[model samples]
Target: MAIISKLTIISILVISFALAFLAFYLISPLSKEQRKEQIGEIISQLINFVLFLWLAKILLNLQLFVQDPLAVLAYPSNSEAFYLATLFTGVLLFYKRRQKKITGVLLAHSFLQVFLAASFFYEFIQFVWRDNPFSFHYLIVFGVLLALFHLLQGRAKPQNQISIVLAVGAAGFFAINFMLPYLTLFGYIMEPWFLALLLAACFGLLIKDPQDEPHSETH
Candidate 1:
């Protein structure tokens, strides 16, 4: 009975983690139409995920399990932070119908995607190097999330600048984090090579503005 209960608890935790990630992703839409469709789905999934997380945090971490308080605090804290960003992003995107703000949205998506990649990379580095635990955990707090909250208040602005190096870095990060043999189960970023190609394409789209061109818009 004890064994069964522990397994059940762990399973629940993993599921909540996955769902929370989905909620985080749902908040990042490339277009207005996509935002409308995605917003509700994301909100719904996030509510379910947060409820599950709160349950687990109270049960496994706070009340029953009696594990290390530090572990409990750290894990659940990170989990809670998942949607905090989208709160600001969603609000601003909701109010501003201007297509110009898409840059901010795209940048947020890129940075969040980088932070997530860096997180898993930190783990990987620890596994291989055993000495260096490279971390990008707070990138959310100091980086994208903070920037987004400002955007919510109309205080945020995005300059039209995309770096080729940053683009390559994004793609490289995706390949390693999501691709590689035996790692495809995560499949979060698709294949590394594919991600490399993908980042290149995303950069191309930002500058190309296919819809702005007469011939492209006609097609």
Candidate 2:
């Protein structure tokens, strides 16, 4: 049963990844140099998420991993806003229809807008409520990185495949870090698993073949 399940999962990832890669190749406007620039911003957002957003999630779930435990019930409310904003940005892509416009907005907003809000709130809470540590830090870092992610993605300079891979890996690391904080209990990948997740997201991106038409802001 375990073997069967593993095979099923592997097959799904393979197929999905292939499609994503194809999509990227198809939609990309720039053949090579320009393409790199376009993807740079997305890569930044991916990396920022790893460093900031995921870090917050990991902290939220820290009780499961460490000694200090907080009320789990409130976590959902905290997480909900993040997920909703993420989803909203994603959905905006499809509604956009225009590849460049959609890509520009998708990469830009996802990486920046939400982060700006978080940053403001972070400072506010820190000042008002006193040192909660977890909330303030998470929001501050997440906001800054999120903005940086957008900025990086929108960079004029081109990014190489290796850099892209590293960015993705960093993004993936936080994803797994947030998802499986206590993998030690289950014999999870002890080593730096961010790279691994980046690899997987890379594969997934390739399979899905997301938009590739090297996008920049419309105006």
1-219 in candidate 2: lDDT tens per residue?
765755553454344333433444444334555444545655544455334544455455677636544443223324433443334444444445344443443343332333334344444444355453434434444454444544554453222332343464356445545754432101122344433543443344322234443343331
Q: Which candidate number maximizes TM-score?
A: 2
lDDT of 1: 0.40
Clash counts for the predictions, in order: 1, 24
Q: TM-scores, in order shown?
A: 0.28, 0.29
lDDT for each residue of candidate 1 in 105-213, tens digit (9 for 90 to 100): 3443334433344334434433344442222322222234324333442222222323433443464455445433322212121345544554554455445343332
How far off is residue 34 in model 2, in Å?
Answer: 23
Query: What is the Å distance of residue 134 in model 1 from its true position?
Result: 13
Provide C-alpha RMSD values for all models, in order.
Answer: 14.6, 16.6
Poorly placed runs, candidate 2 (over 4 Å):
1-89, 99-117, 127-130, 143-219
The superposed Cα distance between candidate 1 and the true structure at residue 52, in angstroms, equals 25
Clash tally for model 1? 1
